[model samples]
Target: MSMNGREKITNKKRLKPAKIVWQVIVYLLLITGAIVMLIPFFWMLSTSLKESFQVFSFPPKWIPDPIKWDNYVLTFNSLPFGKWLVNTVIITASTIVGTLLSCTIVAYGFARFRARGRNVLFLVMLATMMLPSAVTMIPVFYLFKSLGWINTFYPLIVPAFFGNAFFIFLLRQFYMSIPTELEDAAKIDGLGTVGILWRIIVPLTMPALTTVAIFQFNGAWNDFMGPLLYLSKPDLYTLALGINFFKSQNDVQWNYLMAASLVTMLPSLILFFVGQKYFIEGISLSGGIKG
Candidate 1:
């Protein structure tokens, strides 16, 4: 009995150390992945503060001996940076508003109403999400050109009002999770369909709405191809298009470009961080829905 007890104690001690070793390994792997992901942002900051020559230096200096603050100022002065900033802001805001309102309404219809070909239409919408943007880009450009929306913000902002496939799907899932009893009760109180939707459904789905808004904001802010293809006038250029304008045939100012890129990313980053809590909750709630 004494020998059995000693053996059991020894085995317990050995298993504890093994578990601790596995935990340490996992922590090391997570930290390494985080550092790898952060490296590009660090490199951008380093290069943005370095001089033109130092940017191309061998061994890749991580720290600049003399930080050049002029790159940011020069970037703004060399292009219509202010105009680009305003254009991006307007497009992003408009897209967010349109996406939330239209997607929610469409999603509610698909989730609540049972009409002919509803399932087939929903599946078709889902299929569109799988289609590559490149396949439709040229056709969309020509369509917009015929409508005289080229060289204008209309092309950038108007399509968002039609609702996005993925966002509508997401909102539909959330709306399905909401109890039907609430809507039924509102109806008994003499509320119409639109009233129940506006008063009860929208309030309950605030987290999901916020999630859609954040995604739309990010998409509009980071969009490059649409702006490049549509907006020809220098005054209408967004930040994404303005970045291309900075790269001329003869001269490419890497430092200034990096500074401008960093500046362009700030708003999306701030918005994401601020709305992160709701975004997570919205995703979780949507995932819990049936069908």
Candidate 2:
């Protein structure tokens, strides 16, 4: 071997340590971030298991002695928690279905259909996202009241049947990534627009749909204001409203409230963990537009 080749090999060997150092730095940052995020959840769990007295103790107990299993029981027994859970499930399921159906069809049109004024309509829809809920809250409330929809689930579930701007945009970007040739070939085989969408486009975009479903599920499940405004009856109450009512009546019981919060949070946590693969893939694929 030449002298220059021997020196080049030595230089490559020296570069390996720099690469290792950067990798170690990245790993340390990730671990620090993970710990920081988990601290609040850990504290909540610990507080739930503790006695009321132990919650505010001087040193702050990280573990409870008896590990109050009864907090969960008391939380359920104090109110109609089971009924609240059922109501939340109904609202969440309806939103997921409505969002997926409406958003997918709208996005398909925006991605594929060529029509005049299409871009204007899309920009108008996107502009709506800038309008905060506070701006529309009073008019929306009055509209529902005029429809005699107060104290019913109609106000909560019905609006999702229309498309959401953000979900439509996400799905549209994902749909644009597919080659136009596939769509053209489908048409050549005598497939109608709806037929092609259902048979080919829908299957290809399941990841994006899963992302939409998870987002809707989280939004509906955690929604407190919508139910508080519309649902006055205890029987029709969702977990979010019910938990607030419990807090008000009980006069601030931390252990019980934490337990209830954890129960309310479980379904969302489970759904995200289960759908995370598709959820992440969908976000990445839909994050940009293609030429």
Candidate 3:
């Protein structure tokens, strides 16, 4: 072989180790991060199975010796967890429905219609996002109180019937990405605007819609302040508020609290795992070019 060829082969062999080392370094960093993030969760799981006395044991037992699975059973027994779960589910479901319906219609109008002051209205809606919720919380609470919605599910679920700025933007962008030819075809077949939306646009936009649903589900499920502000009745308590009350007991049971938290967290984890594929795709598709 020529000397140049042998030199090239030697250089290639030398470069391979550097690439492997770089990859090894990256993997090590990622693994370290994963372990660091998981430690608190591991501690929670361990503490949940421990006896109340064992929770604060020195040096911190990473493993509960004789894992008391009954902690989970006791967690539900100590509170009205089932009723709280039902309340949360109802509020979350209503919020999702209202969000999807209002946002879709408003977004469809923004994406497809050419009306006066369209861009200005869009900007005004977007500007609302800049205003901190703290500024409006009291006024909104007063409005609900005036409407007799305080202590009722209406305060928790009714506001979502109005379009959310971010969700409208996300859905509008997704709508713009779709080709207009399909709508034209639907029109030629005598389908009206609502018909086109329901039959054509919605089916194509399932991924983005699912993303919105998941986002609202997470938000509504974990919300603390909304319920704290409007829901004065214990019978109307959602799981998040119920858990906060659990933490306030004069003699707090860390194990039971941890266990209840785990139960509260399980649905979100399961939903994310089930819909992660669409959630990611939807977000990517939502960043479409302006029409």
Candidate 4:
């Protein structure tokens, strides 16, 4: 073999170890971070299964020797966890449906229609996202109060039908990313605008739509302030607020609280795992061609 060939082989051999070392370091870092992130969750799980006394035991036990699985059962019995779960599910599902339908329709209009001051309107809509919910809290509360929606699911579920700015932006970005050729072809085949949207755009943007659903579902599931503001009745409380049943002026049931928290967290965790693939894909394609 030529000397140049020998030199190239030697350089390749030297570079391979450096690449492997770099990968190993990266993996180690990722693993360390993952462990760190998981520690609090592990602690929560541990505490949930421990007796009240065991929870603050000196030299804290990572593994509850006498696992109190009864804490979960006790949580349900002690609080109306089942009712809270049902209420939360109802609110979340309604909000998801409302958000998806409202945002997508509005987004489609914004993306497909060529109306006057379209850009200005779009900018104005996007600008709403900059305003904090706290800014309009009082006015919205009075509006709902006037409508007698306070202490009812209407305050929680109805406003989602109006289309959220962030959701509209997300859907609009994804809708714009779709190729106009597809719509044009559908039109040539005697499809109407709504037909094109329903058949062509909807299927193509499932990932983005799934992302929106996941986000809205998560937000609704975890919304504490909204339910707290509108739902004064214990029976109407969502799980986020219902979990506070474990707290009182004198005592807090830490174990039951943790157990209930784990239960409340499960749906969101499951949904994220199920939709993560689509969620990632949608976000990646959402900005395909920034308009």
Identify the candidate with maximal TM-score. 4
Candidate 2 residue pairs that clash? none
**What's the distance in Å from true for residue 102, model 2?**
0.6
lDDT of 1 by residue, 1-291 (tens): 699999999999999999999999999999999999999999999989999999989988999879998889988898789999999999999998889889989999999999999999999999999889999998999999999998889999999899999999999998888889888989999999899889888877888888888878888999998898998888998998888877653688898889999999888889988998985554554533345
Candidate 2 lDDT, 1-291, residue by residue in tens: 999999999999999999999999999999999999999899899999989988889888888887999999998898799999999999999988999999999999999999999999999999999999999999999999999999999999999999899999999998888878888999999999999999888887877888888889999999999999999999999999998988887468899899999989988889989998884554553533244
TM-score of each: 0.89, 0.93, 0.93, 0.94
Q: Could you tell me which 10 consecutive residues in candidate 2 have the lowest summed lDDT?
A: 282-291
Better of 2 and 4 by TM-score: 4
What tens digits encode model 4's per-residue C-alpha lDDT throughout 1-291? 999999999999999999999999999999999999999999999999999999888889999989999999988998888998999999999999999889989999999999999999999998988889999999999999999888899989999999999989888987887889888988999999889888888877777888889889989999999998999889998999987645652577798889989888988889988988885554654533354
> How well is each residue in 84-163 modelled by candidate 3, as lDDT tens digits?
99999999999999999999999999999999999999999999999999999999999998998989999889899997
**Candidate 4 error regions (>4 Å):** 1-6, 279-291
On lDDT, the stronger of 2 and 3 is 3
What value does the lDDT take at residue 74 in candidate 1?
Answer: 89
Candidate 1 weakest ten by summed lDDT: 282-291
Clashes of each: 0, 0, 0, 0
RMSD of each: 3.5, 2.9, 3.1, 2.9
Distance from true location, Cα of 111 in model 3, Å:
0.5
Clashes of 1: 0
